[model samples]
Target: MIVGPAQQLAYVAADVARLAAAFVRESVGAAAAASTKSTPTDVVTHTDFESERLIRHELMVRCPGSTIVGEEFDDLAGKNSVGWIVDPIDGTVNFLYDLPVVSVSIAATINGQVVAGAVADILRGEVFDATLGGGARRDGEAISASSVSELGQSLVGTGFSYESTVRARQADRLVHLLPQCRDIRCMGSAALNLCWVGCGRLDAYFEKDLKPYDYAAGALIAAEARAMVDLPERNGEQFTIAAAPAIYDQLRGLVA
Candidate 1:
């Protein structure tokens, strides 16, 4: 493992995520769609900008000159070796619509590797965080993935693409996956879905075409929870997966 101040980075991630989550909680009702990106269905809200701004400023202050790669803003390079990956509002549509599934996620990287991360479920006021080899925790209590070994009995979570054409392809794949698994849940927020997997609320999770910020933080938490994780690189398409060790290969066979 890369030796770094993982615990300290995790703390920083949690602080920024908490700050961003608070902003989202307060701005949800008043926030409206400022514009659409990629497609009409893919929307962005004023709250998103504000949340990311808050996260960026706080993170920079905490870890001065840290590079920030955020959803709504251009990447910032700085003198520090630390880097941050942030998603201000993981569930933009859900937030504007007053749905409680929204989340704020941030990951801290050192030497180009993710060392720590945090995902805050804003409406629930719960924060999940973890560091490399430190295990996962929700609200400071250790959490782990489910022990379920049977694919037919596992609860799976997933998300679709913003592009309808890609979604159509994803749906076709799901037609096969749903029958093989106990059930499927598409929560509209990849980060939240991944965190749920870490806490055992979800047995496994997989999604296609996710951006880095969407899965970065939550993936670390899930992996630290003893979940079998396969995080994709910045290839043209990123198909991410996290499952209990027992059913990992089984679930991946279906989704892959």
Candidate 2:
């Protein structure tokens, strides 16, 4: 496996994300589910596979022998030494519905630990990136999480499951939390939601049933921006939270 500095890996991801995002942005108008996964609503658009292919090829060419786990076709992944976790299109539903809230996310890991990552907003043209022990940035500008101390004044972000039963249960969980916080926004993309938190557009964000590719890049960006984060155990179906420092405890109390 080839090993490089986390900062170097971060740049590789950011560049590839920009490339893939441009390709995906060009295909959004014709978006439709070519298939489904896990559930009928868990869609897989044609562009999803194409985007992942572009990303996988570029990453492999750039980092020879590196492992890759992508959302579109991860069943064929290689070993996880100097690995990458990628979500070629993080908001597939939004893309399929012709909404502009979509992203391309990639995270580089060294021996199972995330060390660098990047998330690019397709239509927004903003890229958020970070490396372990390095601060976060959005389009080359430094970014930070919200400083809001009161949970009632914090603007939170969340998402729902594709499963109707799980969505209903998640909705019920929000009922108790809704009144306790400023209010939640469901942007349909966990990666973008966590980036929004990193840039202070959202004070906190949490969601259940997330896979590694869904939150890997965004979580690193948020954490580098000084947000507190708690992710699910590897391959476990649990919740992930990225919250402002001052409101971390309070926000987790309500959502966790």
Candidate 3:
């Protein structure tokens, strides 16, 4: 009855993603009853907590002995080294507004290193997933990062923080970056944005003030698809950058 992390990636991740997608689909619109988190712009809803509860329950039943870290609740202790990072709704604002850009993300880590992960684009019904050494995929088909070699030709993706002050600084940085790349997009969901880079929909992506659950799944998927990924860290604040090898350095330099 024991399920390895790889099996969890290959099977459980997708299963949970579908479950999450169903929950999102069923709860869209005013019924979500959204409420503000840090700012009026930062939203959450009953669906977010419910989705995480469902996912955590499933993970506990299928992959027992694994820790569960979720955005909506405190960490759940486990007896083994495996850990499940969950972002039940990665773009809650988008979900609140009935935008089709939200997603559900889950990742499995062992000894603090992510080994498997999945991101479910709820509105699109696409699932992006990967395991360590196993290539990334979207809806079961293999995917890869773009090969665009120059920043001027690359379409980059990014997100702003909910804090207005932080956003002011981020906008200031973007002022320098906007004119350098082919273009930039703010997709709202960091997880999906990273998956977009993995699938070649975007050549690069960067953002500040993210949580571990925000990029855990998508980072693994991007890296597995041959994209270079740097998760946010504590140099006074957290930030993340993921890009195709060809344009990573240029993009990083501009953002830095």
Top lDDT model: 2
lDDT of each: 0.90, 0.91, 0.88
Q: Which tens-of-lDDT digit does each residue in 186-232 have in candidate 1?
A: 88889988888888999999999888899999999999999988877
Clashes of each: 0, 0, 1
Every candidate's CA RMSD: 2.2, 2.6, 2.2
What's the residue-level lDDT of 224 in candidate 3? Answer: 95
Best by TM-score: 1
lDDT of 3 by residue, 1-256 (tens): 8866575655788789778888878887754555777788777899998899999988888888889999989999989988889999999888888888999999988887889899999988899999889789998899999989899999999999999998999998899988998999998999999999999999999999889999999999999999998876534448799999988888878785
**Candidate 1 vs 2: which has more lDDT:** 2
Q: Candidate 3: where is the Cα deviation over 4 Å?
A: 1-4, 234-237
The TM-score values for the models, in the order shown, are: 0.96, 0.95, 0.94
Q: List the residue pairs that clash in candidate 2.
A: none
lDDT of candidate 2 at residue 134, scale 0 to 100: 88
Q: Is candidate 2 or candidate 3 better by TM-score?
A: 2
Better of 1 and 3 by TM-score: 1
Q: Give the runs in model 1 whose Cα sits over 4 Å from its true position.
A: 1-4, 234-237
